[model samples]
Target: MKTAARKTRPAFLDAKRGVGNWAEATEWLRDRGIEDIECITPDLSGVPRGKMMPSSKFTSNTSLALPSAVFRQTISGEYPEETGDFRYDPLDGDLKLVPDLSTLSAVPWESDPTAQVICDIHNTKGEPVVYTPRNVLKRVMQLYTDNGWRPVVAPEIEFYLVAQHEDPDYPLKPPRGRSGRTITGGQSYSIAGVNEFDELVDDIYDFSEKQGLEIDTLIHEEGPAQLEINLRHGDPVELADQVFMFKRTLREAALKHGIYATFMAKPMQDAAGSAMHIHQSVVDARTGKNVFSNPDGTPSEAFFHFIGGMQQLIPKALVMMAPYVNSYRRLAPGMACPVNNAWGYDNRTTAFRIPNSDSAARRVENRLPSSDANPYLALAASLGCGWLGMTNKIAPGEPSYKTVNEGTTIDLPRGLLEAVSLLESEPDFARIFGQEFIHTYAGVKRGEFETFMRVISPWEREFLLLNV
Candidate 1:
């Protein structure tokens, strides 16, 4: 009897030798005395979505399943269908989440020896959820990989530490610093300002170490109680994961110190807004050479084209970079934010900044993304736009020394409404970033804008309540 050939054990199912083996992760966790794990995924707004489970389950065949509608969840706990005539089914069907074994690490602040693992979403048919922010990033990264190149990124995120505000009506205020005094004025780059919050800063460093986050520097920003933390440069995906956890880590550390850590792009109108500036460069995978620079230590055509691509796409992709109504507040004139969608060497006035660096380290610093924007989506859009430039060979003209004063054709969008309108009309944007994603993103943001418009703000009550 010619029996069916015996099925050979594939390396994946074999578990003893595979890239995505969970058994190895479980063994590593047990060696470290971890008893539980927090499975997490960053949603559209960058908020973490997932649950905790016993670490022992990592070795089991079971996977985490969550409703597909979770992706459509608004910041206000409502769905798009409830507020609009969108055609998406918005079903309650479950999508399986596969844990990334590489992300398994211990949670420092937890009472239990709990670890954390970031996950990728997959549908019932075992296909990746292309619209998931992380998956979208992976898809764009694939483009680089296909071209024998890899992207490196470093994220410098600025944020605020404020006293808890119990009432939503009151504006957030800076908490008393470690010197037992509140910051009543700006303290940009003041060592004394950093010293005022020594304990909190120490906790940030300590927690960062425990979590394996390579946060190299902390400096006082222009705003009172504002600080910028820089994560060491590395792979784009790895850096995005670290930034995602770093925000939560800082928040937990802040709460333990009786302060609230906020990444809200514009927590206070009078204070300088927070920005998560991402520095990026591409390197040849085989030779480890920077594609952005020529052999003689000069910027290459690829570099200029990359910048050109970003300039054309930044306005169209502003919705992804800013992502919130308050985000536009930070992008105004005189805020030291953006003026024209111009490129310049070592100039912060332009949205795309080419920081002064040697040939090997030549990179572009995207200064537009707010602290509130999703790291994965932001990187995808930024990198994706650059890819479009490289492939299409877009030309970036002369660097404008003075962005605001420079008579340039760059038409910067002033609000979320305008940004969304611009986004909807971009032909190449929907083509590369996926039409479904662009539609979903713009639609959701539109819903948010409508909801925001319906609200009566304090300014309205104070100014137009009786006069109008």
Candidate 2:
């Protein structure tokens, strides 16, 4: 039996004692008269799940036993009764949740001054549960470290903010073009765009600074209401945490101002889709030099192997990259979306693009994943593919230079069914993701596809129903 190796150590173990631990966290709350705590753990779908505890019961010593089923719940948030009759109640064979003191952070949007902590679920035997998303990421990180390489990542997240609609019955409208009244505007990297959204952007910067996130830049993208935020590169684990927190913070901040923010890949079929393009490289653990860079100012053999790994495993990992039925709509050729499992030097048409920058910035950018994906799962899939590439020495194909919109072709999975089938058929991915996770994820997504197939859309009603 091949046991999974432990990767990066838990942040709680190395966290500064007087900074964010439970004791200091409690004192920080007491100083502000906070009377409530929002204890949460990210579910399979990346949604936070947990209960609010009163301040009196949320002391430093407070520890709750959560059920292992919380990690296996369906998209609708229900557990399978057939599996040991799992329920949210304490009497239902609950697992342990020892507070991860390092995750304690203030909930900036809450009026009562609440703090939130991300927890790790453990079994009765005090073993780390394998089913948890955090654990999956940890295991993958360990693989990288064991290989004598440190993975560094920075995510470029693109999203939109729209006007709030008061009427619940109002029909959804298509996103207007670049000419529409936007919160900001300009050519791709304009300072004027920042000026338009100055206040909101400032709030985001301030909030991130307080939370100790190393945010780099905020820029307005090509789409009318689109904006992108970049975080400084760091260890892959910390980078993933930053991605999770950044999305949560953006949503919370948007809600306070009565604006709607969405990370949906393609909110408008006519416009470019939003992507969470990941920039990644492997570094020498001791010297801190990027291992992917070569002396000739080109990618090293290891870099090609890493890219090959991505290409080989991407078909199987599509479900993780594009989690929803709607996500498939964004994978079409052209419109700045990648259609083929190919790589290029400074080309956006390819699935993986190597930016034409200096050796320091020479890294692969995977363009497949959307902003709505679970960050941990996406990172795991990417890392897994890269690892497989290195292990197998998979050769990367040639570069694609033509624009996807100009009829430049590469074969991509046509629809959700194809993607799901690809994932199910790949043995390499099955080995890494494990049987339980693969079944649960594929089952939920397949269920979603079935639901979507059975439903009639507005397009069908407007054209097919009337014409046919």
Give the per-residue lDDT of model 2 (tens digit) for 1-468: 998987974444333221455566656667657678777766677777777898779884666777666665655554534322222334557777756666666676677767676677677887776656666677787787888888888888898776665653343342333344544333477767656666677778877765666789888787656888988987776777778778888877766656777788777666667888899888888888888887777678889999999987887787787887777777776667887788888888778988877886679999888887888888888888888897789998877776544574546666776777787788877567665666666665665666667667777888998688
The list of candidate 2 runs beyond 4 A from truth reads: 1-21, 31-33, 74-93, 165-187, 294-298, 408-410
Q: Candidate 1 residues 63-93, lDDT tens each?
A: 6898877787777766665433334544678
Determine the backbone clash count of candidate 2: 1
Best model number under lDDT: 1
Pairs of residues clashing in candidate 2: 7-142
Deviation in Å, model 1, residue 198 alpha carbon: 1.3
> Residue 447: error of model 2 in Å?
2.1
Top candidate by TM-score: 1
User: What does candidate 2 score on TM?
Assistant: 0.86
